[model samples]
Target chain A: MAGVRILVGTAKGGFILRGDERREHFTVEGPLFGGWEVFHLAASPVDPERLYASQAGGWFGQIVQRSDDGGRSWNPVDNAFVYDGEVGDHLFYDGTPQPWTFQKVWHLAPSLTDADVVYAGVEDAALFRSDDAGASWGELTGLRQHPSGTQWQPGAGGLCLHTIVQDPTDPGRLTVAISAAGVFVTEDGGASFDPANRGLQSGEIPSEQAEVGHCVHKLAQHPSRPQTLFMQKHWDVMRSDDGGGQWTEISGDLPTDFGFAIDVHAHEPETVYVVPILSDSEHYPPDGALRVYRSRTGGGEWEPLTRGLPQEHCYVNVLRDAMAVDTMDECGVYVGTTGGTVFASRDGGDNWEAVVDHLPRILSVEVQTLP
Target chain B: MIRVTLPAHLRTLARTGREVVVEAAGDPPTIRTVLDALEGAYPVLRGTIRDHTTRQRRAFVRFYACGEDLSQLPPDTPLPDEVVTGREPFAVVGAMAGG
Candidate 1:
């Protein structure tokens, strides 16, 4: 009885898509938290039953909720999930005001090996590490206080850490991507970080890009190959070997380099996929065409997989977490759009089908394979 | 009058079988009145559709009248004739999804 659960968060609230893998019949659980924007959705890798979500509003502060029974019911943590120090008071300096109040938790990832080790990325481009699940969180003082933290400009949403990639092979070796901070890696967990965007073009051109501080939209690490990485940068989809120490552009035949979500095959390192859209002024799909392109050889060549989708005039903007690859036997590929549509590709982006439409502005898509 | 079909979740709450008949003169009228009448008859469905105090539709729950999204349509907006004539049932569905 394998159940595939999709955690969908939007500006209003969140819901759960419960589908039996064998039957393919699906049902949604609840609106969950009403009137709150759920941006980050995560399930504990160690315990599939435990689910976590980060909620925020235009004015309300950020909060994290957890579900013990496969997201059927949820409750907020006893103490609010946040950094150790207060929002606007720094003990080091005489009241310098510690930037923002951790506005949004864009990415929530539990440690692949440690059940209690969970990491959260938030506004002001801060990284918080929790060793005891959501019970207590401490700021990664090293990364938060790095000299480069000051220049890490956020994307349209403000400076925030949107993606966190932990090495399954080496639990201590981890990489995180900030919108404008490019990519940073820590060999000894979250103790310290160094800019790993050596060969990456920071921005549009080689000379113009920051080299290390490029505006990185998202990052995808092959589940098996810890050294190989794929990123949707401000300009292109890039590839990096040797654990993000350097990068090279791989967006050869794609319609445009601008996109949000990039997913690497869980078991196959060479196979990766990304949803492309027009960059700069042409921010939607190419000529208003909505298609997900797959590169069999690590973003070398691209092929548009649009079967069972709109052929013409599909101007959709897929968010960073909206497109995900199911790590199952069928290797399902799913992508949700800002237009409130979710498409599923069971054959790993070879074909596509619209499973649900007109729900709301889909902010994030997460696939959790049940045991 | 438009015939309304409640999903299993709502049907269990409404204690009805297949379809629930709502009385309306013209095209099912608007989502507001349809919900008002539905809840008026089945008080349990009142809080489920809209908040008890504000009477606002619950987030992620929308109305579908004749294959059209009636989520943003004002409560007073009139429904289609097919829905009013019982040819089509106005569905108050909870948008099922999670990510």
Candidate 2:
């Protein structure tokens, strides 16, 4: 029987939730690496048993752990994230130059082809690649060394490169999103990058549609249609048809588009999902009612999926990496909240149920479908 | 042999108990030699106690020996006789940081 394994990263540690194909009941595994902030946990698409975790805290710095037998056991890998030659300055929030420094790893994107290869997105905003699994890492300096590097400023969460989207069809193409620096695409596999924020707009910056200043919260793409992308920016819900060459606002009929999470249905190319929060200043659901808006026709028309979800007195926020979809026959959608609840919809957002609750503040949720 | 007491987290990470022993290679055992031996014994603790590139002790990680704060001392400074001879254990402490 096929099953789904959900890897959840939380403020206190990491947890694994296992559910059979029916997707009804689940057993929670752990606070693996307890007392640490697990920013993200990712499993390799090529090998369901291979997994990587980004664990860090204030008292102790970053530690990358890799597991070969799924999440049963883990061993610490290399945590050294040294910048390549000549670390330069980037703009701080006050518009002053600050030297690039190494911080915790915010996101890890294992290779879609090779189980031994993985890429890490880290704060202080840089990309790193490990060929021998997670044993060692080297910075893909071209992205940071771009001409617009110095002008990029930190968002409220500090300057971090939190997203790395690999082009499923084209091995050489990859897309990465930073907090306040907008999106950048690499055609030569991390050797060089180009800004792809053509249609993105941000009212906070002096130029609303600058080349590289938009705060892109999260981006989602379906494997079948890699060129089409859906984004939940700091304020607007957006879609791009040309692999991020240009974007258009698809925030029509939504209450408030100020959200952090956006994801695509596993098997549907046009189906998309976004959780709408109140506003930029307020991070909770509108009217304390938790709702997930789904768009069957890509965007511009959306319907709220409220069945089995908390409709009132629910003030939790969904983070950018907290929503994921499993590629099962029925397509399971999972959402983890700041209130430490993992909500699941087994029947494609028609109905939902709490898979697990009261663990820790969830940071990221990723699911792997095992055959 | 030099005895070292690691913080609870470090002990957990190194997969050991509170105290571990290492053989310092310096002529007169110093903080640098002791740390080098510790990291050599447990590779996982390389970047945890100090910066990987700069080798500077982490901001919140302090060192103590013989009831004296040795965190501010230079890494190359020789250790006290009691610490070098294993009469007293060198301690690695995580500073009291508020959540």
- Per-residue lDDT over A249-349 for candidate 1, one digit per residue giving the tens place of the 0 to 100 score: 99998888888889987667788888888875566788777888888888879889878777788877888988777778878888888887778877787
Off by over 4 Å in 2: none
* DockQ of each two-chain model: 0.02, 0.74
Candidate 1 wrong stretches, greater than 4 Å: A78-101, A203-211, B1-99
Name the 10 consecutive residues with the lowest summed lDDT in model 2 chain A: A18-27
* TM score of chain A per candidate: 0.92, 0.99
- Tell me each candidate's i-RMS in Å: 11.0, 0.8
The RMSD of every model to the true structure, in order and in angstroms, is 12.6, 0.9
Candidate 2 lDDT for residue A324: 97
Error of 1 at A207 (Å): 5.5
Query: What shift in Å separates residue A311 of candidate 1 from its native position after superposition?
Result: 2.0
Question: What count of clashes does model 2 give?
Answer: 0
In DockQ, how does model 2 score against the reference complex?
A: 0.74
**How well does model 1 score by local distance difference test?**
0.75
